[model samples]
Target: MRRTLLALLLALPLAAQAAAPSALKAEDVPSLLKPPAHGVRVLALWSLDCAYCESNLQALLKLQRAHPREIELIAVATDSVAQQDALAQRLHAAGVDALPARAYAEDTPDRINYLLDPDWGGELPRTLIIRADGKRSGISGQLTPDKLATIAP
Candidate 1:
């Protein structure tokens, strides 16, 4: 029983990490930009190395929690599939593991970034807001409450 319990404990973490974010190749970018059938879609583009990304992600998740019915938040990590483990750890630490998330799986991250926004310039912590009416806005850098209001409001 002791050996069995130890094995179960060891396997639990691996099982949880196995559900890490799905791959987000260049082709998947367009579908993500499409406006949701209802409510707003906030596509948060981030990378593990970005200094401000964690805070920005937390803020976005908070906004989503406040207006769950009005907002649909999707987090896409700009890191390649090789960084999947770190990305998953960060998202889980931020308490956002439940949100729809993806990790860059393309050969180059620029392809995904360009598809996300032509003017993005491969910046970290970028956010693309899409409204139900099909209007879209892309914001880079840390997102403040004022910025969050633009989509949540």
Candidate 2:
């Protein structure tokens, strides 16, 4: 009974996730939007230690696949480059259309997050929807395809 209860408890958090965005730094943002960009950018803020970040990444991959022309997804790594390498492999395997990603370090995390989203409230895996005309929307958690589509071009 204890084991079952423990398992349920462990799984509860995952079940409660909503399609939201995590906070990231300014230096990392540019990596998500490299040259030849469409002038429209959707930033996916992910941390190396967050499991939900990885799952959300996969969801982003799926969303991109479902809507190729509508939006451009920038998978920003709010983690380390070492971690992002593995993430890059996963992204490649999943076929997510991502540019070379930039990693963030703890030393500068605060400044960066504050710059990106002043009211971040310390969240991981945040997504920022940037329109060509510079309009923006902030999503704080996991992602749903419909929400993704709506934020997309």
Candidate 3:
């Protein structure tokens, strides 16, 4: 029993390490808008202090859940990679840790934001809908049901 307990304890750190989000670099920003061959890509852009970011994430998650094959969720936290642990905790708390997520790893966040959307100006809870047909749209606030509906697969 002691060996089993020790093994479980040792695995805890590994589990936590595996949950950290990937790094989002400036160069990778352009590819984020590329239309996938299948399904809609909902790229959720958020920051730690955004009042409505979590709800927006949850709403997007719900939409993905409702249309698993039709919707793909990519959540990117605009927070620095240095704050990865906090961002991971927030994503886990929001029940979106399983989705593909990344944290900004570059020193110039404005550059990254501009790449994501030239008109965005670094707003929190920004969302981008990329369709399979090379169509895209940007939203700079919390996603409403009407907004969410527009990306339904």
Candidate 4:
């Protein structure tokens, strides 16, 4: 009975993780995740408050003008709920939809550090590009429109 219960407990989180969401928190950044309809894997991770992040966001917004449904843009914010609310209002005022970005919770020190960084202890303004089949191209600090497009699967 004990072993079975333990096994079931272990399996619970796997079930939750496998629900396969369009967005999942990666440490500090909320990742825009979607399986390629054509078997291509692609993902982007980013934070707010970084100049490079801002440029990246602009490029992404521009890209969305043409391909909003093609790529999933999950802009993860590390700010408090109040701060994120204000930011969301600003985005709404600019006519940017909330679907592109969402607030990521840093619920624990380890998760927060991983989301931010351990090497540089950086926060905000990060992007992770993952390929189809779960192969990753690596994460970037700042990205341009061209650069962002270059990682498309």
Give lDDT tens digits, candidate 1, residues 70-129: 899989988887777788888888877778889989887777788888878888789999
Tell me the deviation in Å of residue 133 in model 4.
1.7
- Candidate 2, residues 1-153: lDDT per residue as tens digits? 999999999986553321112333465555543422454566677765665777776776666666666566667666654454465554554444243344565566676667666777658778877776666678887777666667656
**True lDDT of residue 122, candidate 1:** 84
Model 4 TM-score, 2 decimals? 0.55
147 Cα displacement, candidate 3 (Å): 1.3
Residue-level lDDT tens digits of model 4 in 1-153? 999999999997664333222223453243333344543333333443555655666666666555655555555555543355455654444444343455544345346546444443444455544444654444566665567676554
For every candidate in turn, the CA RMSD to the true structure comes to: 2.5, 11.4, 1.6, 12.5
- TM-score of each predicted structure versus truth: 0.88, 0.62, 0.91, 0.55
| Best TM-score among the predictions, by candidate number | 3
lDDT of 4 at 97: 39
Task: Please give the TM-score that candidate 1 achieves against the real structure.
Answer: 0.88
Give per-residue lDDT, candidate 3, residue 118: 82
Report clashes for each candidate as comma-separated counts: 0, 14, 0, 5
- Predicted structure with the largest lDDT when compared to the true one: 3
Question: Which runs in model 4 stand beyond 4 Å of their true positions?
Answer: 1-48, 93-95, 107-123
Candidate 3 lDDT, tens digit per residue, 1-153? 999999999998786676678899988877888888898888999989999999999999899999999998999998998997898889888887878888899998888888888878787888988899988888889888888888897
Clashing pairs in 4: 27-115, 28-115, 41-131, 41-132, 75-101
